[model samples]
Target chain A: MQAKKLKYKEYLEKYKNCPTSDFIEVERDAFRWTGTDVSLEDFIPVNIKRKPPARILDDSDKMCMAYGLSMFDTLNNALKKYFKLYKKQRIHQQEHFKQDKGTKIAMINLTKNDGIADLPNKNNFGHFTFHEYKETNLVGKISDLYSVFKSNGDFNI
Target chain B: METLIFNSERKLKTENFARIGDLSYFEGPLLSLFEDLTNGNFYFFDWVDRDQDYNRWIIYRVLPKHLLNFLNRKISHLDLFRQRPEKSVYFTDIDFENKGYFYYSAYEIESFPKNYFPNEDSYFDPEDCNSIDRIKSIIFNSFARQKSENEYSKVYHIHNLKTKTNYCNQPIGRRSKRTTSVNKLFKAIKFEDLKNSPSFDYYSKEIKLYPDLRNPVQANIKEDENKYS
Candidate 1:
């Protein structure tokens, strides 16, 4: 009559075997954000330039290095969750939280055509991930896929 | 045991110099040359996979500074050792293994010429009496290859040398791995090609030069209050 608590291994197995389709839906929105320290040129996918922090995911054996996004139904809900997680992580790391400057958030539309995949991770429930197999393929595709905007103002591109 | 004796004999035969625990010693211009080579540019490529587990390679474009850092612990990264890809080198990092043991392949782009010397003002030359033998002596004397994974292959281990105690906890063995990806990268890029390659410009171009005077999140809250009031 009581619910079972999942162990770490069981949790890993549950997510690993979880049906991919359950996590991602076509035409659903995914949100990703960059810190205020990042600039616009960081979004450029040139081989010589450093990638934007939002676009560069943590390296892991379980998953290929790719852009990490949180799937949410609305922009407001996504922003609230993003800030909450950001604050929690900063506090966990014993780092001081700095004032949000001109931070940028990108909203990406997931479609069957984009070749994106759902990788339900324990770190975040709504994690949607994608990666380009080749470096050259990423050069022009990044800017085209996501609609970016300033978090504070009406400025967007 | 036998390997250590052989190495000591080789050093003595070549350089006529032998020290008990000290690995190698250089003097004058040769010291500067050694410093330049050890601290120079290098490309590091590493990845982890379900099947392969962990793999890494250090490809020396000039010489390997990473190895020197590993030896001396000049820079410490707490638990993780991460090197991001730039114009010059590939990206790599190790998160799981905090055991203070590293296994990665290391390769020199191309072998230096037998006749090569640092400069015309050098004391010894191949054309002179103390020629190719002296230069070869320096190379062999400096890093003694103790254990060989293969009969023909050379494996240089610096475990016996006195190393500084640091956060990463002094990794013991720096062994080499033989993999197809390492060979491919070695063949694809050449030492001459990297001469004109773009240097790292991440700090200059990507980082914000100035912090914002006002917090955007706070300003957003104020805007919402104004609209409601």
Candidate 2:
């Protein structure tokens, strides 16, 4: 398990400096209710316990350990791919699970900068998917990432 | 004027709860269950979809402090069900025949209106009002028509005092009639109006069942029998 984990870390290290473009985090309607105002609380990692509440999607620890912010290259792509999967999941819920009416999808546009690019690697779908290492200061890492985007005014609807 | 002494207190057990997703909005069947339970009132919500052969219901009870903290965002959604103060919320899902699941949860209110003793009168009797058998009975009766006549049928029902809508399946021969009735009902009702209605009363005096988690089966055996029946 240790060797396998290191492999993932080595894979992430390879793309630490890769250049990337703006990506979108498909958000829930609950997060976007405030309209254009950027709530840093929304960006807080699920592992950390403070604040206005972490995103529910982050609860899936299997996806990405640190803070999995699943994103896509563009809003349309996210809608076409991610949201399509989400809608199908909703239908499945209607058939065999509890349907949550509030699971509506929305999007947030974020600019890729030095701070974000340094985090880890991007997937083929244009997501800056990263995992946390043992030595990483998770709270500080997330706060710094949020600051980089907030100060640069890179948050957009 | 009568002084009501709030004397009774009930706390939830630590190991009986389960966490779901966040509570985004403050209103819904789940939230309503929490509020009613917090105020010492009994409440339940149930639904069925014959097409999927699925059915579900939830009964709730809660502590006032926890509810207040939850509403104030003092308790993050992640920690909503975490054990605290030697007690935490309780939740369990008991499955039944025919793809049915009954969910029950509670953290008894800290106190009740002075001189008010909680009993069956606090809410309607569960056996008569909200029970797995009651829901099953509805489904059985609705589908019996199709089984006897050799026709296709579908049934769905969502029972809640707030929504006040009951939809049941009809035989294929009555499909058009059912569709017309459902369409008419949809056109007559406005979702905006339902959203605007006052659904909760924080100071409500009604008291609900204080579940004995240690012996849930003994406390509510009829509902528990769904495991076998």
| Every candidate's lDDT | 0.26, 0.27
Q: Tens-digit lDDT track for model 1 on B1-229? A: 0001111111101011111111111000111111111111222221111111221211112222333442243533111123322212211222233121122212222322212112222221111111233333433432432122221111001111112123123222211234323223323433334234441121122112112212542344344222211
Please state every model's RMSD to the true fold in angstroms.
Answer: 27.4, 20.9
Clashes of 2: 5
DockQ of 2: 0.02
Give a tens-digit lDDT track for model 2, residues B126-164.
211223343333233324323422211111111121233
Please give the lDDT score at residue A128 for candidate 1.
43
What's the true lDDT of residue A91 in model 2? Answer: 32
